[model samples]
Target chain A: MTRYLRDIFFALAALTIFVAASPVQAQSNSGPLRIEITEGVIEPLPFAIPEFIAGSSRVEDAASDITRVIAADLAGTGLFREIPRSAHISPITSFDSPVQYSDWQAINAQALITGSVSMEGGQLVVRFRLFDVFSQEPLGSGLQFVGDPDSWRRMAHNVADQVYERITGEGGYFDSRVTFVAEEGPKNARLKRIAIMDYDGANVQFLTDSRSLVLAPRFSPDGQSILYTSYETGFPQIYLMDLGTVRARVLDSQDGFMSFAPRFSPNGRSVVYSLETGGNTDIYLMDIASGRRTRLTDSPSIETAPSFSPDGSQIVFESDRSGSQQLYIMSASGGEARRISRNAGRYGTPVWSPRGDLIAFTNQQGGRFHIGVMRTDGGEERLLTSSFLDEGPTWAPNGRVIMFTRETAGADGAPAIYSVDISGRNLQRVSTPGMASDPSWSPLLQ
Target chain B: MKLFSKLIGVVALLALTACGGGGYFGDSPISGAPGGEAAGSADPNSVAYFNQTIGDRVLFVVDEHTLTSQARATLDDQADWLLRNMEFNILVEGHADEQGTREYNLALGARRAASVQTYLISRGITSGRIRTVSYGKERPIEICSAESCYSQNRRAVSVISAGPGA
Candidate 1:
C-alpha cells in the first residue's frame, strides 16, 4: 500500500509539472476567447503542419510522408482542419528554431506542429512538439520516438496519437487495426475471406482464404490473436488464429452443436459466444486456457451477440424472449437479465462501448435498419445512421466512433464497412478494395 | 429443313459425348438427375424426382418460423414422398432473408428448421430419419431486396439422402 501510494504521488507530481510548464493564458476581462468545446455545433479547429526537417538526406522522403500522414490523421477526425502548405508564411528549417507565432496567428492557425526526422545507426528517430499559436507557448513538452526504419508508419501513428491525446484529453485510435470479412463475387454466391488492416485501411493482410465461409472476426485484447467462426467442416465452429504465425485451430467444436458470435472477455482469458443445442440457442462462456465451459443463459428464446462491458462485470446482449428481439443486460456470470430497450423496433447486435458508458446496436424498424446507441441502462437512445441495412456496430478503442456494415438495396447490393461518430456526425465510408463487413476494431496498438 | 437437321446433329453429338462420359459435357444434366441416372428416366422413388417433382422446399413469411398453409402443403407432399422412399433419409435446411442481424438470423433459421422437423415428426416420420441444418441468410437462392426475392429466400428445403440401410 505504501508503494502504491508513492506511485500515485509521483504520477500526480509529474502531472503538476506538466501543467506548470505549459503556458496557459488566463481569460481576459473582455470575454472568454478560448474554445471550451463542451457541446453544440463544432467548427473544426484549424492547425498548420510544416514539412518536418530532415536531419539527414536518407530520411528526406520519409520525413515528408510522415508529416502528411500526421496531418491527415488529425484532419480525418473532423475535429482539426489542416492549413494548406502553400498558405504558410513561415518556414521551419531547423528543429531547434523558435516558432513564429505572429505568422501562424495571422494565418488563423490555432495549433502549429513542427518535427524533425533522422536516421541513426539504421534506426529512425522522430522528434516533435506542438504549440498554441495564440498564446505563444508550447502546448506540451517536446517528445522523441525511436524505432526501426521499416516501422515508419507506426512511428507516425504514435506521434499523431500523442498529439491528439494532448489536445482532446482522449486517447487516439490511429495506431490500431480492424479485422473484417472481405467479400467478393455475386450476391447469391458471395465469397468471404477474413482480412485485417490498419485503422486507415492500409497494410491489409488476408488471414483466411475463401474456401470456407467465415464470419465475425474479433481481435483478442492483446491484438496478437483473432477469433472467428468458420464453416470448414460443413458446420459453423469457432476458430482462433495467431496473427504472428498465421496458424489457426478450432476452439470447442462439440460434435452436435454450433458456436458463433464469440467475443473475448476484458481480461482475455475467456470467450463468450452463442451455442445452439436442439434448435434452442443460448450464450456460453468458455475459459480459453482450461477449456472449461459454463452456460451463461439457459432461456429457450434466442439469446446471442453477447458483448462484455469494459470492466467485465456485466454483459449486454440481444434476445427474442419477449416475442421480439430487444436489448438485455445481465451479470457476466449470467442469470436474471433486465430488458433495456423499450422502443418499438427490434434491436440486435448490442456491443458494449470500450468507455463502458453506452451500448451500440442495430435497430430495425419499418423495413429500415439503423445503427444506434443508448446508455448502459438503456437511456438516451440515439440512432447514428439509418439505411437499408446497417448492423454489427463495433466501437473504436476510445468509444468515440462506431464502425458498422451497410448494404444497399437490390440484388447486386453488397456489404461495405462505414463509420460514424457517436454524436451522429462525420459519417464516413471506410474504403476497402471490394466488399467488407463485420468490422472489429483492435485496441490501441503498442 | 436445314435448321431441323442442324438441331438433330447437335442433339446426336450431345448424346454421343454424354455416352463417352469423360469430359465436363459428357456428364448427365446437372439439375434433373443425380447419381448418373438417365436423363429421361424419371423414377418416382428417386431423390431427384422428389426434389424436382414434389417440391422439396417451402417458403415462410418475413421474420417468421411458423409453417404457413402453403408451407404445410409442400411438407405434406415431402412427408408422403419420404414415407414411400423408405431407403432415403432427409436433411432439412433452414434459410432466411437478408433482413436481420447475422447471429439472430442464424437462430431464426434454426427455429425454422426445427419447425419443419416437428411437422415432419407429427406426420409420422421418425426422428432418426431426419436431420437439420440452418444456413441462415448465408445461402439465398434469390438475391434481390424486393418481397418476391425475400419470400423465395426465406425457405426450408428438404434434401434427400440414402440412409445407411440402403
Candidate 2:
C-alpha cells in the first residue's frame, strides 16, 4: 500500500457507449462510456497497448514488463481482445503525442491504452491514459502511480484495473492472489502443501512443506493470513498461518475431534467450519479473538463447507440431511437452515460469490462432475464445467469467474486448477508449481 | 481430507524401531503350500495368517456407511481373530470413492470406520483395542474410474499391530 496514486481527477461520469446501436441507445442517451456485458450481445472489444514508452534506459526493462502484465490482465478477461502490435498503424512513441484516431481506427481498434514508465524521487513512476478510439477523446483523465521498483507489477495491475472499471463499471480483480494446495507425488501418495500466487498464476510461493497433507487453503479477508486444514499430527485440524512469518498454529484443538473446511467470516473476527466428533459431522462457528465456539448444526448427517455471504449476514454450505449431499443456507448466528439446491444429483463445496448474487458449487450428475452457479434463492442454475472430477469452486474477486480442481481419471489421475467465466466460456487452466487444488482467492490487495 | 492415524500403535511402533509396516498388509499372499508349503499364513497366530485367512477388509456401496451382511460376516471373523490374538491392536482405516466432494467424502469415510469399530465393540472387543481413521478418498486400492474399481475402493481395512509389550 506504499504505492501512491497522484493526479486524481474528479471527472464527470460521462462515458460514451461503444458499438452496437441497439443496446447503446438504450443504455446511453448521453451517459458515461460503458460496455454492458451479456451473452451474445456484442463482439469482443478490440483494443491495443503498444509497448509503453520508457522515459529513460534505466527503466527499459520495467517498462516492457509492466506493459506485458497489463496487457495480459486485460486480454485474459476475454472481454477485450488485444490487437497485436503488428496490427497497429500508430505507435505511442511519446507520452505527450497527439491522438491519431484515424491510424487506430484503421486497425479496427475500438479502444486504446497508452502509458509511459520512468523513475522519480527514487521510485518507479507509471502514467497511463485510456481512450475511445472512434470518439477521439480520452475516456477518463490521465492517471499516474509512484512505487518502489519491486512493486512495478502492482502498479501495472492498478493501471489495468482503472481502465477496466472505467469501461465495464465493475472493479477489476487483477490485483488479487489465490491460495491453494500445491501437490506432488502419485495419487495414492500425493504429497500436498499450501501455496499462494498472483491472480494470474505468477510469483508462486510455497507456505508449507509436503511432509504433511494440507487441503482447502483460504485467504483471510485482509489477505494477511491463511486458514487451512492440515494432517500435521496425523489428524485433520484447522490451522491459521500468518503470512508474515510463514508460521502456523492450530486454531481449536480438542483431543479426538476432526475439523476441516474452515472459512473466515467476511469481517474476519469469526470462522465457520465442520467438526467431526464420534461419527457425526456438523458445522461450528468460533469467535476468533475469544476462541469461543458454538455449534451451528446438530445432526447425524454431514454438514460442512461453510461460506459466508459478502455482508456476513448468512452462510451457504453443503450438507447431507436428506440422505444425500446438497446445499443449504442459514443465518450467520446459527439457526434453522433451508435447503437451496433444487435439482439434485449431489451438491457440495458451495462457495458464495463475492458479488453476493450467486453461490457456486460442485455438482455431481450422471457420473460427471460440474462446477455450477445459482442465484442466492436457488434460481437460474447454470453448470459452467464438466469433467471426471471438477470440485472445489472458488470465485474470482469480481465474481465473474470461478477456479476449481479438475482431476482426470485413472491410476495416474492428477488434479490441476482451472477457471471459467460465469458465462460458461473462456475456460482455461491456471498454472501452479505442480499439481494443485482447492483454490481460494483473496480480495484485492490494499 | 484426513490421513493416516497410528495413534493406537505409538507404543507398539516405538518398540519395533518403526518399520511403519506396509499399508498393503491386508493383501499379503499365501506364500507356501500344504502344512508348511506356504511359509506365510502357515501359523494361525501370525499376522499374515490373520490377514490372509481371516480377511482384513470389507467393501461398502457408494455413499453408504452401513455395513452389509457380508461385511458383518467378515467382522465376525475379524473379532474372533482379535479375541485369540489378545496381544494385538487394530487400526480401522476407512476409505471412500472419488465420486464425492473432498470434505463430504472424508466425513463419510469416518462414519464407515466408526460403524466397523462399533460393530467390533458389540462383539466384546474393548475400545482400547481399536482406533479408527479415515483416509477419505485419498488411498484407493484400485484406480480405475469405473464402478469395478470404485466398489473395491470404498472399503474399511482392519490393520493389526502387535501391542507395545509384545
Candidate 3:
C-alpha cells in the first residue's frame, strides 16, 4: 500500500509540473478567468517539497531534523506530496539563485523548496524560498525567520506556511501553535495539565504542573498569551499565561464559581469565558488588563464554549436553553441571544470562522458526534466529520481548515488530534505523545 | 405540584444511595438483604454476576457530577447486589460525552465516580472494595458520531467482581 501510494504521489507530482508549465490558460484572453474547481469533486493540489538543504549553523543535532519537520507538516495534510529525495537527480544547495527547472521536471516535482539556516545576530536565522518548478520562477520571495535554536521547529512551520501560501493561493496554518490538555496516568487518577506545542506536535511545553486539572487553553490573537481554565484553588478559575516570559496570572479569581472554556477576542484585549454559578454556566467577557467582568448571557441554561466573531462585533456560544445544546450568537455588548444553529441535533462549541461567514461547532444527533459548520444567520449547515467522538473544532487562521479531537471507542481508546479542510477533502491525523484533546489553534505567527 | 415534582425527583434520584460505600445485595453472606445468592456463587475475583444484557448502566447529565434519580436507582440495586455478595469488588469507570473539553470531562468523570463511591459507602459497601477511574470521553459505550450516542457515552460503568461462596 505504501509503494502504491508513493507511485500515485509521484504521478500527481508530475501532473502538477505539467499544469505549471502550461501557460496560464486565459478564459477570454483579456481578463483573469476563474476555473470551476468542479462540483462534488475537487482535486487536491499536487506539489513537490524536496528535502530542505541544511543551514550553515554547524549544529550538533541531526541537520535533517528541520527539513524533515517542514516536509512532515506539508505532507501531513495529505494535500501536498514530498518527492522522495532519491528521485531528484540535481540537488538544490543555494536559495540565492534560481532552481534548474529541467532537473526538477525529470523527477516529476511540480514545485521546489530550498531552505538555509545560519546563526546571525546571535540568533538562528532561517530562510526558505518556494519555486514553481515548471514556470522556472520564484513563487514568492525568500522568507527569513529569526529566533532562538530552541524554536527551530517553529521556524520550520513558518517556512512551511510560506510554501503553503505560495502554492495553494491561501494562507498557511503551519506557522500556528496548538494549545491542548496533556493527560497522563491511569483512568481514575489521571492527571491533566495545559501544554502548548507547535502545530505539528513539537516542543511540547507544559504551562502548568499536573498539580491541578486544566482544560481548554486558547491562544490570544497575537500568539503571545493563552487563556484557559484551571482547577487550582478547588474550583475552576480562568488563568492567563504569557508565552514570552512563561509567566502566568489569574484572570478573574472569583469566589465559589467555575470559570472555563476561555477564548480570546480578535483584538486580544478582552477574553470571553464561561462562568458556572449555582450549576448554571453563562458566558462572560472580561478585560484582561482591567479585570472587569461583563455578563454576556443572563439565561438560566448552560451556556459555554463562547467564541468571538472575527471583527469582534458579536459572540457565538453553546446553550441548553432550548432543551439541548445549540449554537447562539449575540452582540459583544450583550443583549437578546439569537439561535444560529437550527440543525437537527444538539450543537456545542460554536467558533466563528475567521472569515466571519460561518460558525464551526460540534453537533450531536442521530446517535453520533459530528464536526459541522453553519452560517451565522442559521443557514447552510454542513457536517464535516463523523466519528464515535469528535469535538472541539478550532479554525486555522485562514478559516480554510478545522482541527479537532477524535477518539476511538472502548475504555483503552486513545484520543488524538485531527485536521480536516472545510471541504472535507483533506483529513490527516496529527499524532501527539499521548492522548490529546481540546486543540486550540494559535493565530498566524508572521 | 411542587411536592409531586419533588417526589418524582426523589424516585428518579433514588438510583443513587446517600451513603459513601457498601456492597449491594448479592448471593454472598456479607451484611445486607438476602437475595444476593447469585453473585455469591461466583469466584471472589470473577466478574460473573455482571450482566451485559441487563443494560442498566448509570447515566450522567451534561457536565454534572451528581447522580440523577434513575441513575441512583440503578446503583441502589447494584449496591444491594454487592452487599449480598461479600466477596465482590467493583471498579467504577467514569465517562463523559464528546460535548465538553477533554480535561474537564476527565474531572467530571471523577466527580461521577466519587458520587457513586459515596453512594456505595452509604449503602454499607466497604470503600476499599470499590475502585474508581475516569476515562473521560476517550472511551464510548456507543459507536455512533451523533448526540444520541454521546448521551449514552456520558456515563459511569460499574464492573462487579465476586468470589465463590455460600
Q: Comparing 2 and 3 by DockQ, which wins?
A: 2
For candidate 1, the C-alpha RMSD (Å) to the true structure equals 7.8
> Per-residue error at A196 for model 3, in Å?
0.8
Which of candidates 1 and 3 is the stronger one according to lDDT?
1
DockQ of each two-chain model: 0.32, 0.36, 0.05
- State which candidate has the highest TM-score: 2
Candidate 1 per-residue lDDT, tens place, B10-108, comes to 543444333221121111122212222344238777555665676678889988999999889888988998898787677677789999999999888
For every candidate, C-alpha RMSD to the true structure in Å? 7.8, 6.5, 12.0
- DockQ, cand. 2: 0.36
Error of 3 at A403 (Å): 1.5
lDDT of 2 by residue, B1-166 (tens): 1112232223323423443222332211121111322345777877656666766788898889999999999899889888888877777777899888899988998899889999999998998887776767877667788899999889888877656445
- Docking class for model 1 is acceptable
lDDT for each residue of candidate 1 in A54-106, tens digit (9 for 90 to 100): 98888999999999889988888888899999999989989777788899999
Query: Could you tell me the lDDT of residue B144 within candidate 2?
Result: 82
Candidate 1 backbone collisions, by pair: none
Residue runs of model 2 more than 4 Å from their true location after superposition: A1-33, A38-42, B1-40, B161-166
